[model samples]
Target: MISEPDLVKYLPDCQFGVNSATRLRFDFRNSGSGERVRAPWYRPLCRQDFLRPRTAAMEYPLGRHNFLRSNNLEEMQDVLGRIMCPHRLSYLDKPEPLDAVINSFDLGNLVLNYVQYGVPIAVDPGATGDFYALQIPLYGNALVRSGGKTIISTPEIMAVTDPEAPLYMELERSTKLLLVRADWDFANRVLRDLTGGLLPWKLRFDLGLDVSAGRQCQWFTEVVNLVRRADVGGGMLKGPMWVPQLEESMVARLIQLHAHRYSELLATPAMPASQRVFGQVVDKIEAMPEQLHTEGSLASEFDVSSRSLRSAFQRYLETSLFGKLWHVRLHRAHLDLLWATPEETTVPAVAERWGLWEPLFTQRYGENYGETPEQTLRR
Candidate 1:
């Protein structure tokens, strides 16, 4: 007798956007205020889902860059430790030949990874490190243990892990995962800025993603895909300009949309900053966007603390100081793109003039005006 294909068994070939590979890994919705859901690790897939023949010899793209064709557990562990994170990989089943793949991208303080394993395994990251992680399962599922809590990470639900804690996971034979990591400082700053300096305590996210209505998962996915597309086209990751903007937007969105210890505080309406403080920072950003304009430098320039400056930007502009600077540079680049002649100006040249790269410029332009720099130049 044949059984129906469970959700994990089959993936549509044409779903991901990149020519190589890009797919949403986590979409786990919170169960309830205090409810915990445990999903099974193993789900049988239909034979038709096999790419070639589901034989002992098969290769899968790691993420977007690497591939795993060999089943050697040591090689897999070594590659993972070097490229993504360090962990102990152990087979749960009878070590019946392993097959796996991994792909990763680093953007500013945020790291994204896509991984899949063909055999049941146990993963124990002794300590998660100084970064927060959100693990989403694209195909199949896994059981994650962290902070004395066990949560099922599946397609409809994601696991949120605290960086200061240790975590363990049990993977199914066909488990594929998408993981997002944010630096502690980056995440902390985003929360503080978003709340207009009213965050009086540490911020902690719930173990599960808040997929409940109005979550910013869709927005986060768009940003992730946009970066992937730019990288695939080439030349975007060459500079630091566009990366920080994308990273800040991504982090800020996560804080605003997800359910966490500070969710209620973030949702509280923020008080506006004083006009005097706002004007001072805007002047500095407009006058010298190309300068090493960190919050510390800007605060020192205007005789204000970094916290004060962040609050001013958050309260008045609803963005970080760097975010405003990004906008200023972006606008200048847009004008230059319009004035540039195709014979003398290239996308890279124009982008470099504003500290951005060609691919980023193209992506940003398309996003803002629904046209690319090349298209804009043609007209």
Candidate 2:
């Protein structure tokens, strides 16, 4: 990996025109309604639907994070360079009316950036530096060249630029891309942890990434959720604790979904929570069992991912997170049944008080305590 200073020195100025062009803006239909986007953790998206339904001619992706909208190629180069590593920008085709827009948000060591140079442009970032790039086209197709391989990237077929490699991209005018810029150190740490490897090494991904279905689809869903949260101003990723978890979830999914060198070892059953994360989740659950809970909601509240939270509960408590919640609710309901008379309350009432139905309560109670809720109520 090259140092930042050395990388800057080697890269020359971007060569393109400063031609003025039309400007674009974002549309916020339901800005503060609190019901605009109800995104959860990594809900797999339909293979065909890459962008959210809010995407119209008016609504823009990453509209909330928009910081730069310009036509000057030099200014675009400098501005984008400050956020990402320095790179040379040129024209791949006859430059159409140029109107470049950039919106970026940082999550720990990762950055979710939306970039659209409204023309056919070529980007030359000689060596990718110490960062990985997941380039997913939201609108148009692109020619990706890196590490002696070339692939045509589209909405379904994404492109990944490895940390230590020579990379260039020929983007079409219709291209509106969502780039996930990740620091090599932090991302590699996640891969190492997920693989339970002793040492850290640069994990290389294949040139082309297919988000058509399966884990790749799930990974894209997570990426979109992160971008949506940033755009929606949920303050979810703004917290000190959630930033790391956000990065962890993003990189962990890439490691698990994308093909890599040690992908075969991933099936080796990752180790359980060694840190205090498990206790934190347990305390939250035991503290408030009556609250309406979902795996995604609990994970969000605790600044963790749904999958990680589930893994912790499964390994430590010998049950799922919801399974533990069920026991807590059942215990409380059992006490209510024992203390109250039939005139005061019935089996249905006691079960409903704890967010359970009569039959479910009765079945679970019988399984655990060798009796039904009705029997307990009568006693």
Clashes of each: 10, 0
> What is the lDDT, from 0 to 100, of the residue 355 in candidate 1?
73
TM-score for candidate 1: 0.67
lDDT of each: 0.60, 0.66
Tens digits of lDDT, candidate 2, 1-379: 1112221221111111111121112222333352443221123321223244444322456777776888878888888888888999987776544678888887758888988887889988877688888888876789999888999998778898877889989988767788888888776666654543355457888889887665576467557756765665533343342345446656766877788787777655644553487787777778887665555455556655555665777678767655676678789888898899999998876665666543345666898789888888889
Residue-level lDDT of model 1, residues 1-379, one tens digit each, is 0001111111111132221122322222111232322322211211223222132222221224454535778887887777556889998978766766666676758777767666899988766777777787766889988877889887657787877778899999757776777788777876655544445666667777733223344543443444344334333345665455456556666776777778776566544446886797798789878765665445545655455666677677767665576568878877777887788787777777777644345666687778887777766
lDDT of 1: 0.60
Which ten contiguous residues of candidate 1 have the minimum total lDDT?
Answer: 1-10
Tell me the TM-score of each prediction against the true structure: 0.67, 0.62
Best by TM-score: 1
